[model samples]
Target: MRKSHAFLLYLALSGLCFCGLLAHGLFKKQADVEHLEAKCRLARTLQLTDMCLFTEASYTRHLSQADLHTAFQDYPMSLDHFPSGAIVPPPEIVRRTNGKVD
Candidate 1:
């Protein structure tokens, strides 16, 4: 009986710890949502208010863009595909945000 009681107590503590970490993660994710919301709003000004543009997929894609840029920057073959004088642009805030560039 005592062993079972101790096991129950351990389970309770483990559950509480898991809940605490979940809450922390959700709170941190809110900032990511807000950042993406702001970027989406900017895109909206450019008439890019498509449903996907404001969705989580777009946010995650943008988040990964910088990483992709970094990975490709080191590869000489990547730039060789584009024109010699053409400069690769920075990672976009979101897709289609550069549609109006001169």
Candidate 2:
């Protein structure tokens, strides 16, 4: 009836909706895990490499194949030209080996 009570009710409903969406995603993904695993296995069987994440730059296209200096090619402190550079981090192998592929 009151403004404060209405606001509280709205907050409660929104929170419930958020929780419901999260639960739906969790369950749906769990159900799809088997299908995803099968696809992964098929990809491995075909020797398929990782999917391209960003089409802007060669380094951004396939992170695993990118060398360390490609990102800083312009200069040491040069800002990234591709927006995806900020979004996708260097792969773990690149970080562990400091960009040495072997």
Candidate 3:
């Protein structure tokens, strides 16, 4: 009878521990889902902003083209100049291995 009681006690403790682990896993999964949902919302907002910028750029380019054509017809001899002082050298690349740069 004592052996049977000890076995029952062990079974009950094991079952409780398993339940605790299962609850912890479910909670972690819920947190992960919430994090992913937040990221998805942020991505959607960024896409909408990018679409708006693209639309604005398209309109601006169309207006600029029309103005340039009108100006060319009115003054065919005008020339635009680029400033020579704006040139800059590109940066050199450095290689790295195992998170350390040599």
The number of the candidate with the highest lDDT is 2
The TM-scores, one per candidate, come to 0.35, 0.62, 0.34
For residues 59-98, write the lDDT of model 1, one tens digit per residue.
Answer: 2234334333442454646642334213334445523554
Q: Give the candidate number with the greatest TM-score.
A: 2
lDDT of 1 at 20: 100
| Residues 32-100, model 3: lDDT tens digits | 998978877987977532222222233222332223232233367643222211221111211112127
Q: Positional deviation of 7 in candidate 1, in angstroms? A: 1.8
RMSD of each: 11.8, 4.2, 19.6
Off by over 4 Å in 2: 72-102
Per-residue error (Å), model 2, residue 56: 3.7
Pairs that collide in candidate 3 are none
- Runs in model 3 with CA error above 4 Å? 38-102
RMSD of 2: 4.2
List per-prediction Cα lDDT, in the order shown.
0.56, 0.85, 0.48
For candidate 2, write residues 36-57 as lDDT tens digits. 9998998899886668558888
Between prediction 1 and prediction 2, which has the larger lDDT?
2
